[model samples]
Every structure is written in structure tokens, then in C-alpha cells.
Target: MESLHGKVVLITGASSGIGRAAAELLSSKGAKIIVNYLSNKKGAIETVQRIQKNGGDAIIIQADVTIKEQVNAMVEQALASFGKIDILINNAAGGIRQSTFMDASEELWEETYRLNINSVLLCSQAVLTHMIPRKEGKIINISSTAARIGGAGESIHYAASKGALNTMTIGMAKELIEYGIIVNGIAPGMVETPFHEKFAPNEDRLSRMSATIPIKRVAQPIEIAETIAFLASDASNYILGEIINVSGGR
Candidate 1:
């Protein structure tokens, strides 16, 4: 494993699931972590505690990434604490539920776009200001398999949002490459996270969904974290503008 010693990583949606797992794994590799959460203050605090207990440095910051001001403030806080940000993990996202285009409300579509796509743009923009000056950075966006394969009977809006993120990642990578900023994305398939609890509340439906993966199992949060860690490390220095799929052979 490439050592991330002394590197500072800022992770959005760090309260739970993949984001939380990434924070813990990266911290273990000797990176100072900034846990950014919108409403899960308790979860963020717990993540920070766990990192500290493991002899890792970390801090929790609350910010709604969809808002530009909040994202800017959150990045400022991270820079103030660590002096510089070496990596940015855009993992914050809104939940998706089954809804046909005709059945989807305007409010739902707008909110989904705001949280999923807008947050990525705002957070990445905030990071670019500081990262460009340093001429080096790593940005990892947590997209979804829905963006690639499309989710059926569910929020097409959510999938659309993630699709936009993929485009943004590619565009930003091309634009920022000269500055030594690597931008990449991960499109995860049916992971076992609190996401199901919010989207598919029915226990039977969740079980059936898990059975669809070719690996015969849902991905663990740690699995995605490990991939993110690899991309953030020096080992992936040659990679740029790539979207890695972490689906268990879906």
C-alpha cells in the first residue's frame, strides 16, 4: 500500500456508509481526515472518535454540500485545520426511491439534483481554488451504478444526477490535469448500506436486490473504501479521468 502519511483528506457525507468507511481506512494509512456531514452530527462525532482511538487525526464539520457558501466554509475549515487538502472525496448524495417519470414530482427531481449533482460541483469548486494554487490534488467522486445501468422503477432523476457527475468528473479531469489534479469517479452497485433502508423499506425487496449481484452478495462499505484509498494514493498517479465500477459483477 502506498503511504498517505501527512496527507490531508476531506470527505463529504462522512457521517455513514462509504464515506465513513473511507475516512477510517484513509486515516489508518496515516492521512489526517476531515469528516463532513450535513445533519448526522452524532455519526460524524462517532467517526472522529473511532479515528482518534486508532491514533489517527480527524475533525468533524457540518455542512450541506449543496449550498455553495456551506461548501466553501467547510473547505476553509479543513484548510485551517490541516493547512492544505491533498484529497477530496465527493460522497454526499440524496436517496433514491422507485418512481416513474410521470409519478415523480417536480420537488423530488429538483431536490435530487441539488443534493447529488450540485453538491459535487460546489464541493469540487471550493477544493479547486486551494488545490490549483498547490498544483496537486486528488478528487474522487462516488457515483452509482444507476448512472451507468440505470435504475428501473426508481428515481430516474437520481440516475440522471449521477450521470451528470460522471460527465463533470471527465471534464474536470481534462481541465485540471495540467495543474496536477487527478479527478476520478466510482460507480458502485447495490452496496449494503443504510441506503436500502431509506429507499427499499421492504425487507423482501432488499433481499431480492442483493441476490441480483453476480457475486451473490452485496458489497461492504469497506470494499468501496479500499478502492477509493488506492485511487487517492501515489500508486494511481498515472490514472486520470477514469470512472471505476465497484459493482460485484452486476
Candidate 2:
């Protein structure tokens, strides 16, 4: 990726799981990474250390994307350090806890929407202020297949949140393209990451999930990260406002 060399990519929730994978892979391809973490300071530090160890340029910043103030501060700091943000990856989201619709609490739904959808709104708005002026930027969001399936399980709120994100991606893509900002999303299938640990912790459950996929396996974090990389790069120039599914044929 000749174009990726020295590009500045800010990745939210970058301390672990898919976020960490994107940060590491983008940095490996010579992109300068702004690794943002909300609560996992240890994981954030490890991500930075790994990038530095591999001779990649990176810096770690902690900010809860769900909060407007924190999101503002994080984007400001990135610009202060890097002068500009070329890519924005909205990956800061969670299911919070798994529970049936009847079992889901009002508080759980609110928090899930805050973390999953609100963060995307807040982060993209903050980054767009600068991107619009430059007339060039890439915003890649992490969505889920559940958005289409409607999460028959306890992840109804989670799926709903991502569904909102997917719609926003399409709208933003069309709205931002005239300004040279490309907004797209990736809907990854089951992946081997801490996400599953939080969502489906049991080994047998994971096995059952994997067996159900057409690939007979879950995705590795890097597999999803690699897709994000393509979306951020020049290779994705014509792909606007589309949600590309990376679900291993699921």
C-alpha cells in the first residue's frame, strides 16, 4: 500500500480485539496509528508497544467515544499531534451483556446505543469538521451481520445499534463524497476475538457458532482488519456508502 505509508489513521477501541488488529495491520503497512482506548489502558499500552516494537509509528490516547466531550478531546489531540486525520475507524462498540428481549433492561439498551451508535455519530462529526476542509478522508465503520438478521437472541439492542450505523454509513457516504470523504462500513461475521468472549464465552457455544458458518470457522481479527485496510486505501475509491460483508460466506 504505497499510499498508506505515513498516513494517519485514528482507530477507536483500538486497545483490543478487532480494533487492535486494525491498528497493528495499518501500522504494519506504514500508516501512523492513533490508538484510542476507552477503559483498557493496559491493552492500549500493549498495542502501542507492539506497534513501536515493530518499528511502526503510533501513539495511544484514552477517551470514551460515547461521550461527546471525550470524543472532541480525542479528535483534537490527534490533530494536534499528527496535524491531520486521514482516516477514521469507528470500532468502539459493545454488546454490554447478552440477554433476551424480555430480559433486556432499559439501562442496557440505552448504554448499548450510546456505545455503539452514539460513538459513531460523535466521532464522525468531529473528524468531518477537518476532513470536509481537506476534501479528502476515509471513515470506516465496523458493523455486524446481526444488523440484517435482527439479532434473534439477547443482542437485539446491539443489532439495532449496528443497523442504525449501517444506515448512517450510506447516508454519510453520499453526503460526504462531494467533500472527498468516503464513508463505508464492514459487517464482519463471527470472529475470534474478545468480543465473542464477552458475547459468547463458552467453548461449546463458540464451536456451535463456528459450525453454523458456511466456512465452518470464525474469522480471525486480522481478516477483518485487512478488509478495513482495503476500505481505507485508494483501492476502495469507487466503493461509496456500501456495507461490505466479511462473514466467511455466512
Candidate 3:
């Protein structure tokens, strides 16, 4: 992959999982990373430390993507620090717990949409102000396999949220293409992140869930990060508005 040296990349949810991995990987390739974390200060700091240890430039910022003011401040901070925003990885998301459609409450559904879909829209809109003038940018939305194949035990609301993200990616890609901003998405399947521990809770059930995948294993965070780095780099210039499934062939 081509180096992202000198590029300013903003990644939400950089406290852990695929977001953290992507921050480290992209920074290693010379991209200046803005590590945005919602609450995991320690994890986010460690992510920055890892990048700095490897001679990469990175800074940690705290923000709740679902909040418009926080999202605006995050983009402003990134631009203030880097002077330009080259890429955005909308990886921050919430509401991973499983719930049936009938059982899911209105609050749960609204929260899912707020975090997953609304955040993407807010962040993308914030970044566009800077990107449009420059006439160049890359926006990568982190979706999930649930959006493609509906989650069986999980709330339909979560799937609907991600489905909305996929739709936004397609629509934004078409709208932003004219301004040279490429929008794309990455849908991962059963990645071994702290998210599973929080969502599944039961170790035995999690193991059973892992067994269903064709690969017979869950993906490591770096596995998904590698794909995001590729999409953010020059190598994926021709790829826009497409959702790349990182499901281990499931």
C-alpha cells in the first residue's frame, strides 16, 4: 500500500478494537492520526503511545460522536492541530447488545440510531466543510455484517442502524464524488474485540457463535484495520461508495 505520510486522519473510537489498530497502522505508515475516544482515556493514551513509540505522530481527543457539539469540536481540534483534514474513519459506534425487535425498547432503538447513523452523518458533514474547499478527502464508515445479513438474536434496530450507515455511504459517495471526496465502508464479521465480551457476556455462547463462521475463528482487530488502512491510502482511489465485507468468507 502507498504511504499515508503527512496525511491527517481522524479516527473515532480509537480507544480500542479496529479503531485503535487502524490508528497504529496508519500512523506507522506516516499518517498523522487524531485518535478520538469517547471514554476510554487510558486505552486511547496507550494507542497514542504505541504510535509514538514507532515514530508516528498521533494525538488523543475525547468526544462522543452522537453529540453534535462534541463532533464539531473534534473536527475543529483535528484541523487546528494538523491544518488540514485528509481522511476520516467514522469507527465510533454503540448498542451492540442483542435484543429482539419486539423486546427492544424505543430508547434502545433511538440510541442505536443516534450513535451509529447520526454520528456518521454529523461527522461527515463536519469534515465536508474542510474537504470541499480542498477538493480532496477520504471518508471510511465502519459498518457491520449485521447490516448485510440481519442479526438473528440481536435487535433489528442495530441492523437497521448499520443499514442506514451503508445507505449513507452510498449516498455521500455520489454527492461527494464531485468534490473529490471518496466515501466507502467496511463491514466486519465477528472480530475479537472487547465489544464481544461486553455484548455476549457468556463465554460459552460466544464460542458457539464463533464456530458458525466459515473461518471457524473470529478476526483479530488488526485484520480489519489493514483493510481500513488500504481504503484510506492511494491504492483504493478507484474504490468509492463500496462496502468491503471483512467477514472471513462467512
Candidate 3: residue 137 Cα off by (Å): 0.3
For model 3, the run of ten residues with the poorest summed lDDT = 148-157
Instruction: Score candidate 2 by lDDT.
Output: 0.92
* Local distance difference test, each candidate: 0.90, 0.92, 0.90
Question: In each prediction, how many residue pairs overlap at the backbone (N, C-alpha, C within less than 3 A)?
Answer: 0, 0, 0
lDDT of 3 by residue, 1-250 (tens): 5799899999999999999999999998889999999889999999999999998999998998889899899899889999998999999986656787888988888888998998998998998999999999999999999887887476578878989999999999999999999999999998888887688778888889888899888899999999999999999999989999999887
Tens digits of per-residue lDDT for model 2, 160-186:
999999999999999999998999999
The TM-score measured for candidate 2 stands at: 0.97
1 or 2, which is superior by lDDT?
A: 2
* Candidate 1 backbone overlaps, count: 0
Residue 231 C-alpha lDDT in model 2:
92
Clashes of 3: 0
Q: Which ranges in model 2 have alpha carbons more than 4 Å from their true place?
A: none
Per-candidate TM-score against the hidden true structure:
0.97, 0.97, 0.97
Question: Candidate 2, clashing residue pairs?
Answer: none
Q: List clashing residue pairs in candidate 3.
A: none
